[model samples]
Target: MSTYQDADAWVAMADRTRRSIVERLAHRPMAVGELAADLPVSRPAVSQHLKVLKRAGLVCDRAEGTRRVYQLEPAGLAAMRDELDRFWLRALDGFKELVEDEGDPP
Candidate 1:
């Protein structure tokens, strides 16, 4: 939609720890500690990364007892994918227009 501040914010969220967290939770929800156990980051670090992901709208969480379980948010990912798709499509269309406007190729 419109424009994001920069693709970097979302791309940065795609880093190793974040991706691992997202992948782990994509199938099922998990607590931060559980995810931290599987990752190299400390629990707090995992929580911090989760905060970033959540801020970017890439992940969502729900209260389960006293803990918060995190899961991937399909709508956010879809929005990001749509933006990327539109960007590439427009780029390709421009390339095509340029080539066509050049007359016959040498």
Candidate 2:
């Protein structure tokens, strides 16, 4: 079963800006200024999105000199992937049951 934190991660990623942030972080960890440069949003806006992502456990940050560099949280990403896998497995199971029932005589 998915926990509230897992649901929050999904909600956090529903935003386009947040998804873009995740995509960038997938390539490399980056500080706020670095992320803002590649994105259309302002640095502060990027920071705000980072906050949401962090709160959802989708990302983590570390202080490097004066800046905080952010990267994807592998455990959180794995949890989401596990949930998706469970969902697909359940759907396939149901489909198999339906097909087998159709093969039986009335």
Candidate 3:
């Protein structure tokens, strides 16, 4: 599969359930069953969320003996973080420009 964009990760995490799953995985890796057990969604639903996350490059899975374990993908998370940092830097620069303009004679 092609590498996913940071926007894809943002879209995938826009859902409450998916965000919850991400948060859960942030703490530790888990199987779909374990995720479903703690969440209100069904196992199949959790699996579906996993699929979206996987496609977005936010999560990856590996077979662990019998069950497939899912965990956060640091590269994907870093992409999102980098995007956020860039956005904040742009906003801050714009604010600084406005402040400087306010003090200018013209």
Give the per-residue lDDT of model 3 (tens digit) for 16-103. 9999999999999999999999999999999999999998999999999999999999988888888889999999999999999999
Per-residue error at 21 for model 1, in Å? 1.4
lDDT per residue as tens, model 1, 1-106: 2246236447746598898888898888889999999998899999999988887778889998999999987877787888889989999999999989898767
**Candidate 2 versus the native: TM-score?**
0.93
Candidate RMSDs in Å, in order, are: 2.8, 1.6, 1.9
Q: What ranking emerges by TM-score with the best candidate at the front?
A: 2, 3, 1
Off by over 4 Å in 2: none
TM-score to native of every candidate shown: 0.77, 0.93, 0.91
lDDT of 1: 0.83
Q: Which of the two, 1 or 3, has more TM-score?
A: 3
- Provide the overall lDDT of each model, using Cα atoms, as 2-decimal numbers: 0.83, 0.96, 0.92
**Number of clashing residue pairs in every model?**
0, 0, 0
- Model number with the top TM-score: 2
Off by over 4 Å in 1: 1-11, 98-106
Model 3 has an lDDT value of 0.92
